[model samples]
Target: MARRGVWELEKITLYYCLQGGSSQGTRGFVEERLASFAKENPQIQFETVIEEGHPEAVGLYRNGYKRTLSLRNLEPIEVHDHLLYLRNTWGEPEQKHSKISYGVISNTPSVQGYWRTEPDLEAPSSVRRSYLGQIPPNVPPQFRSFAQLQRELGLAGVTELLQNLGCSKWVVSGMTGVKVKSRKKRD
Candidate 1:
């Protein structure tokens, strides 16, 4: 099978913008920092842009996502760090996510013994249940759980059943009824 991937440019493009009317020193400072960084890593491509009113350093990734950070009044050290940060990124903003210590490795081999097709240890009879302990033991062969009733009733069946019972009262619950709870009475 062919590998699925994005059409990314082999070289990174550091696209920056400084206001045309700004001090010449600002442009000089930015260019100096960029030049130093470019010299440090020769693989990156620098594309400088001077938009008259816009003033920010933008990291234009091969993937087309641009990260723009203001460098208007910042010192050279800060700008240098920002440039380093932008250059090191995968072209996306810091995503909102939790720090996960363990991850699922789908391709891990079973020889490691961590990956298994079946249960490694048999759970105690008291701890384990057949059919998730859902099916009633006394249920006859032909009978099934109230699966259809749950579908027809929907949630606790309060709203729909209330309508069926000719009760005009409105029941306030969330949009999805799978997380059904009894209506709490107000004081």
Candidate 2:
């Protein structure tokens, strides 16, 4: 038979890490998030199986029969740490929302050592620039155009720019532009 999309219910297992290293708290949080997501998106069903230890958690993902969803922070797993592993039995092994792992490491042992040295990080420069650049100086009194409005108000930051432009929120609503409820008074 041909395969279908990820929404098609087969069986899926999810593994999530609990904060601080407590299995009970981690399991509770995982169950809560899973239940909430499942309830919100009724089409997706999730079943969870908790492993005994961190190694067992890893092993469950590595060799378990069912497809799994593992949720973990980018932080490194330290010695004598406990992690939560969630497993599902009905779906494909890899899904579109599957969690992937990345790492940060240093030769020095102390946490302070990593912060002292500069590393090539992919920081969001565009967002910073957009927030910091001065607003232009030719905006109309009514604030009709983006360029004129952004420039005339002398907006020092995104908050002021958005406030002056009558944008109430920052969400992408359509292809053309964000759908912001106008704050301007209706005359």
Candidate 3:
């Protein structure tokens, strides 16, 4: 008779935790669910590697194990910003408060800065129209009020508003050769 060889299976580790008020119940529920899930799906096996500390969880993931649950939940805005930070940290800072100011340049044409304002009109109405054109034509009735527009445009915030009616940040910075300085801090 020929001798048979035994194959060895590699071990996998999984990380999970219970947070806040119902940690005990949450931990029990997760353990029960995972056990049942593993039984139902044998193709994917999970083994609890460690039960304590943030370093342990990080190690599990680093060592090729999957995390079972998020440690915390964030608001929609917070989630958006967090993802934005992960993707890229370089860019104009996010607009927080709106401010409005006006000034004239010697070589450059006179333009408005800060909150929404009328255009010089002498330059060209097309440019002005395009700047204001960003406003959606089908604005809901509730948001059609001037107050709503002001709020949406960031006109009532702490930062000053730019007056160039037709120029967007791109055009102002690129075409007219104006530099925009953001007042927000970079993360």
Candidate 4:
């Protein structure tokens, strides 16, 4: 998707009503102009349906996404413009963007300047070694299991235990975390 290649509308389903305000005129214009346009583009297939509703153009792409443009009360030139728009575009939703800058390669950290290509050039820790956030490691007095932590503190103790372990999605508490809830209160 980064480097877009030549893309043409795979299929054009022109739907128009048999008896309507502008449907008849739109259908006539399509038969005369748009039908031949599709023929010129061999990769594009055209089909006209006499539906019971208003005139509309439904474009089908190879990626299985469909786009529809209502051709209500429009002239042949206007309909042609809309058709060209659909044919050229990928048929995706439009979003407003002020400016687009190069995105940092995902693995490369884009936030704080903590990343370095050479590991040896890294800075040493700025905090104390005692509670330097070394977690899941045996913190002498800290509870390692959720049940043990709950017994001493309470349910909120289990939450704090998880928070201490970096609170990342990859970090998860085991069944001990849930089974602790079912235990009767200690009198």
Candidate 5:
């Protein structure tokens, strides 16, 4: 069909099997709906060819390019949608999409590289080594263990130990540099 201001679509050929289960929907479309569809789009020539394989539709363009859509096992509505899609297209070979689409280009390379959740196994040992099981080297001696901290301070310390172990309410007095701020009991 020659669109007034668009590319010309010459013809569409529908191919379907006569007895295959896969062509049931295509047969239904041909028997019940094809006539009305052809009448609706009068500019294009529609032809049906009996074939022995899966159902498909091929649209030929005046520019010599053709588009094929598989209609195997599709509902009548889906088959109609595929025909509409083929009718609207320009009948050119599809282009492969790229990772970057726009014209914007970065002059500088990424310094930090791609973000990752896990450590890179391919990296150097120093870069990938983790302190997950054993204690990290940067921890202070007093912060290491309660026994070691009690031996260093020489006091029967329970609240201090719990405070060191991250209890914020039990404030330790006199040994650590922090002063205890008394809070009034809430009613």
Candidate 6:
């Protein structure tokens, strides 16, 4: 997108209906601002076509690529911005974008452990902490670990108790690795 130059755009055509309500802003833009814009961008040919439809701005590139943008109900400034955007574009079809995860990327091994929102699912039950730091006095000794509390009350009940105790999401998330030991043993 950075490499796209305005010089690549050979022509810009603004289509509008002379009497349509949706084309009112475009009409005003053509009448008041388009002349100056054309004068400023002397390299590109600016043409205004009066048609019976909603207003639209189209850009034709030197590579035979074309891009169109709806100008319906847009103010003169907005129309100018759209034109500027069109001038800078390569007229390529839109592509799907992946979600960007913000985290430290390093070639070397991290001195401190990497940050995690959720616990390691593959870790053994004994390896995972039942709670974050020390347990508070309000919590009973019988329910020393979050796993013990979860077994007696179930997940929903445990969540309610945590909420009532004013535990934040971070606190609960920290204890997600807490898995209770099952009575059945593998041979």
What does candidate 2's lDDT look like per residue over 11-105, in tens digits?
33434434335444445545445455445545444455555443123322223344322333322232112222222233335444424633444
How far out, in Å, is residue 133 in model 1?
36
Residue-wise C-alpha lDDT for candidate 3, range 1-187, written one tens digit per residue? 0113211112224343444432343344345554554464343334564354321111122224322233233333342333223222222234455355333326765465444476332324575344433445655453345324434654323122443333233223212222434344459
Q: lDDT (CA) for every model shown?
A: 0.52, 0.40, 0.36, 0.63, 0.71, 0.74
What RMSD does model 3 have?
23.1
Residues 1-187 of candidate 5 have per-residue lDDT tens digits of: 3357764677999999999988999999999999999998887899999989999999998889989989999988889999888888776887757887744357886687755797543434442233112344565455446335444553335445555655555332323322333445569
> How well is each residue in 1-187 modelled by candidate 4, as lDDT tens digits?
1116646468888888878987866776776797677766777787888878889999888778898999988787888887788788775667555458443447766566655575432124452122222344543343345435544665355456655654533222332122222223458
Which wins on TM-score, candidate 1 or candidate 4?
4
Span of ten consecutive residues with least summed lDDT in model 1 = 171-180
Candidate 4, residue 155: the lDDT equals 39
lDDT of 4: 0.63
lDDT by residue for model 1 (1-187), tens: 0114532222433333454543243466556766677787665666666555535666666667877776665556776776667666676567665677445546666665565686543334443343223445555432233334433554356346645655555422222112223455569
Range of the 10 consecutive residues with the lowest summed lDDT in candidate 5: 171-180
Highest lDDT scorer: 6
Whose TM-score is higher: candidate 3's or candidate 5's?
5
Model 1 residue 12 CA deviation (Å) reads 6.8
List residue ranges in candidate 2 displaced over 4 A: 1-6, 15-28, 55-69, 73-187
Q: Which candidate model has the greater lDDT, 5 or 6?
A: 6
lDDT of model number 5: 0.71
Worst 10 residues of 4 by lDDT: 170-179
